[model samples]
Target: MRSGKSKRVSGTGSGSRKGSGRGRRPGKTAGTSHHAAYNAGVAEGTSLNQSGGGRLSGHEAKLQMNERWTRRCMAKGASAGTAGKRIQESRAFAAGFAAALGQPDSAWQPVQLTRSAAAVVFAGPDANPASIRQLLRLPLEEIIVVQEGASEAQFAELKALPEIKILNPGEPLGADVWRAVGARVTRADIVLFADAAQLIEAEKLAQLLGAVQAGADVALVSYASRLGPFREWDDLMRVRAFVNWTLGRKELGVSSIGLLPHVWARSAMDAVGVKMLAVPPLAHVTAIQQRLRVQACPIAKRTANESGKSYQGLPPQASRKLTNESLQTVFGDHIEALRAAMKLKGARLAMPDNSRCRSAAGGAE
Candidate 1:
């Protein structure tokens, strides 16, 4: 028999974990002007309340408003919901335009003076010498190839390209590759690290350098498939890449999408202390901890067909596994690491949208 008196529940069980619902909150609504305004504020680093007659100047207010709006759209996209998805996609479209405007006009004096950049490639004995030669052609002050005993034939082929240096580790593959690169990059302003199998498109290096001049300490290239052979695989890889990119932009406050023709400012790398590339493929967390301003630039025909059927060549599955492993590696200790980095760098880890980029441009060098 059941008792007539109802038993009292001890706790109100904390409301569903934040961001568990489908509807808007009291102040946050989708597609509304206020929502847009709030996002603009967030992006510009000012509060709505401070816009009208507060400490922020007119330019500051405008910048803040734009940034807030852009971030709102990005945040909405990163969140789960129909409205959120729409906001995210819309903002992404807008971001393209913002990126263009973000660049200073040719008439404007360059805000930052760019120094020579170095290209560092990590190759194995089986690496494609022809592809490596093609990469060496990119406009860079120097190119260094770190190989596990690069054959004399390969060295001779690479030597044909002026300003290219070949370094043999004569050791096992791993951290030593990165050390070789770090040592060779003493005089360079930036270092680009890519695999031997990857092929970079024209103007890719220039675009990366442009991003650095625009204030991004580290710029990575986004690639589209060259051959139709791996369209399905490439598509899948893109989805995963986008997801990872979105996560880093929204949740982690970092950029992690795109292929690894990673271009980094020498100062930034020195600040982080040069180390081997032991981190997983998606080095989002690692970069964040290093206080780097990472950006992703889309490139045409940046194709990398993994050599043979080896794990490196595998597409989406391999990417997913590597991403997971990266997350796990930093799950516990790295949270603090990221927080410290953010504080030190005063970094804001969010995907920049058109409005935000525009706002950034107003102050961009």
Candidate 2:
């Protein structure tokens, strides 16, 4: 989802400038030889495919579809043993061809460019002034803070800051609406959305901005720990990640583990309507549907001690339930698309190796 626009110049009256975890660090350098690099890239792609890092390639995808069909055949009374043999044969053929051909180098390469970025923080009641001040030090052109139903007293502190734009939206526009409003007013080449208390270090911002410059439509921050209290990633997050890669929207195989302090290219945001809720599942779904290049970069995870009052506002239990419900509401209509795309990976998306092993054992007569 890389765009071909010149870097946006910084707006007037900025005080100064500045320079710019966890999930498996992106694969090391792909070595010198084109063949070797290509193979390495393919291996990374395969790893990503299995791990749900991105989408499966065509040959692999066909094989996945065939496997699903074979499962259906077994479900309808075909011999399980024969169906299993066909699955193995297809995989063998796929392995031989994939090893020889490898994936395109462009698939692994990160889009690179130099551009200015803007940070849009959704300032809730528990917004952290210190975190906001820290974020301001990054080499961004502007900062826009969205607060729903903010009073004059609430506006006083944020408005006092130079180069900051405060959007009250007058009425409470709920989570996604106000964020969308704030993004509409953001005028930088790259737009980042983080919570008021989310701690996004300067180093992380540089990596994210680099991805956007490199032509990624959206650059996400993937933390080392599980994003929420859920035992697994939310169902919609998993489905979106799979669909994005399976449909070939993004090449750099970053996991859609979580979206926080995420950065987006203005064009990409506009391409897929910007919905800036406290949580933006729909924003990601639209990006995938539009085939935008979405990459996930890893950052050191934030700790409970670090989160403080922000976590307290929406207590973990309520937060978890609401998050699940919101994502469900956002994605309910798109379940069929999710189901079809998920078949490319199947239960692999839901089960870890151990669970698969246990289930396999339990199935034995």
Report the number of the highest-TM-score candidate.
Answer: 2
Tens digits of per-residue lDDT, candidate 2, 1-365, equal 23443232232221121101011112243123323323333453354445542344332332232333334434555432211223223223223223323322111111122355677777766566665665543445557788755556766876766456677766667545655776767667887776675544443454566567667788765432344544565565555545555555443232441345667888887776555333355455556656677776544333112112112111111112246666666465345555544555453333345535556577411
List candidate 2 stretches off by more than 4 Å: 1-113, 149-153, 224-258, 275-279, 300-365
Report the poorest 10 consecutive residues by lDDT, candidate 1: 103-112
Model 2 scores a TM of 0.50
Off by over 4 Å in 1: 1-113, 183-185, 223-259, 280-283, 301-365
lDDT of 2: 0.48
The model with the greatest lDDT is 2
- lDDT (10s digit) by residue, model 1, range 1-365: 12222221121111111211122211333346444432342233322333332333222222332344335545654321112233233332322212222311101101112345556776665566665544433334456677665678866666564445666656775432454354444456756666675544323444565567557777765433222344445333444344444335432212242245567776666565555244323245556555567665544323221121111111222222235544455343334444554554444434445556655566421
- Total clashes in model 2, counting residue pairs 3 or more apart in sequence or in different chains: 11
lDDT of each: 0.42, 0.48
